[model samples]
Target: MDELDEVLPPEVTATLTEQLAGWADGAVTLAPRIGVALVLLGLTALVAWMAGQVLTRLGRRTRLRRNLVDVLRLVSNTAIWLTGLLIAVTVVFPTITPGRALTTLGLGSVAIGFAFKDTFENFLAGILILLREPFRIDDTIECEGAEGRVEAITIRDTHIRQTDGQLVVVPNAQLFHNPVTVRTDQQFRRASIICGVAYGEDVDEARAVIEKAVRAVDLVRDDVRDIQVFAHAFGASSIDFEVTWWTGSLPVDIRASRDQVVAAVKRALDEAGIEIPFPYRTLTVNAPVPIRSVDGQG
Candidate 1:
């Protein structure tokens, strides 16, 4: 140890020399302590990798993993890699005292923290999101005025894919503090379409047609919810009715429901000969007959 002290930094080498005695001699060969530490670190790395694989298998049985399996796989992989890194550090420097370790780590840690502040914040937010589960991975959520399916949640952000073939990434912290709508979790969501008919058309006939159309859809709920047909307004062009139906719309998959129901109702009305009234404009024209009077006299 005394001889080895010559090769090390003054502060650390003196401490190491006093503890190890002849174990770290001036020999060009490696010491048993170092060799053992290396072996332990290697074992830990292998174990960590194995644990990651096990986690992937275990996560499959979980609901979110079943729903967002890819995200779960990624999280497990990250955890294993982090554990392996920490084990490597601990094994390489076994006798580092608490105070000495802190002193050595001080500046580097501060710099690292500053550089990764946003990243760390995002990671912490992701953990909270997983734990709290405000919404699941496949849930239809509304954030920042955009609606979409939650594709994935990572350390820095949450991903969503909208109907328009756009992918949106939201910061993790915003999720913790903002209001989000989870529509997919519900058994059904109420959808309403406003339509207007000519004032002279029978409101009762229109209502009946709409109800029949809504009930015909296989996805519409039959109980605890029903079709709503009510006179919503009396406009200058026509009378309006609000047609509402409860449907098991997939989380973030609303366009399908909207298009299907609207199309069905429109077809039903067309079959029933119910007019979807349009605005009207009246025109009047007057022509002078003085030119015809001369021809009649001739």
Candidate 2:
């Protein structure tokens, strides 16, 4: 300090020397606490891992849903880590007690919640979804114009593999608030298609033919539910029959059954000589002057 003062201004030298000394003393004082905090955090990591493993095994043994098990594991890890961090913090700074830490955290959480309102909403919704089991992974669902199989349900979002092979990450809150159509809620579902025949075709006969054709479809679950054919509407050219049958609930299953039913209905109608009509047109000219025959006579 005396050498620095001789070469430099006394005021600057004094201030610089004092700042360096203070920082060194502070670091030395903090080193042991920092080491202890590190050790505690290491222990926290181990405990969190152990807790996760235990929960996973317990869930499997108890035959809990996969998503529910995941939620349990996540919550356990979060709580353990939070507690461990609080303890480590208090050790590093003896001035911060658990009560004070909690109070500070509570206030911080309010700000965090406001800043991430949607995130919290999604997290809560995800928890409810896991608990309620409204739908499961691999179940096909339709919501908000997105239709697909559920791949995974995390705390913030759900992963859906769409029918066309696109992956969609949908926020959990949206699903919780809106209506979700679980296509595979049951083993089988009812599907209907309109089959229009010529207006002159017998309605009763068409209905019978359609019911028989639909029942013959390999994918149709006629044993589970009856095949139904009702005279539904009259069109410009044809009388429409509402053909309905029970089939597998999956989208692929429905599509396959529909394909077979359409083919079978067409084949049956053709064999029965029932005409599936096209629109017919009639023309009348206001001033009809002449008519020409094959020989061009008028």
RMSD of 1: 7.9
TM-score for all predictions? Answer: 0.64, 0.84
Model 1's alpha-carbon lDDT is 0.73
- Candidate 2 lands at a TM-score of 0.84
Best TM-score goes to which candidate? 2
Error of 2 at 273 (Å): 2.8
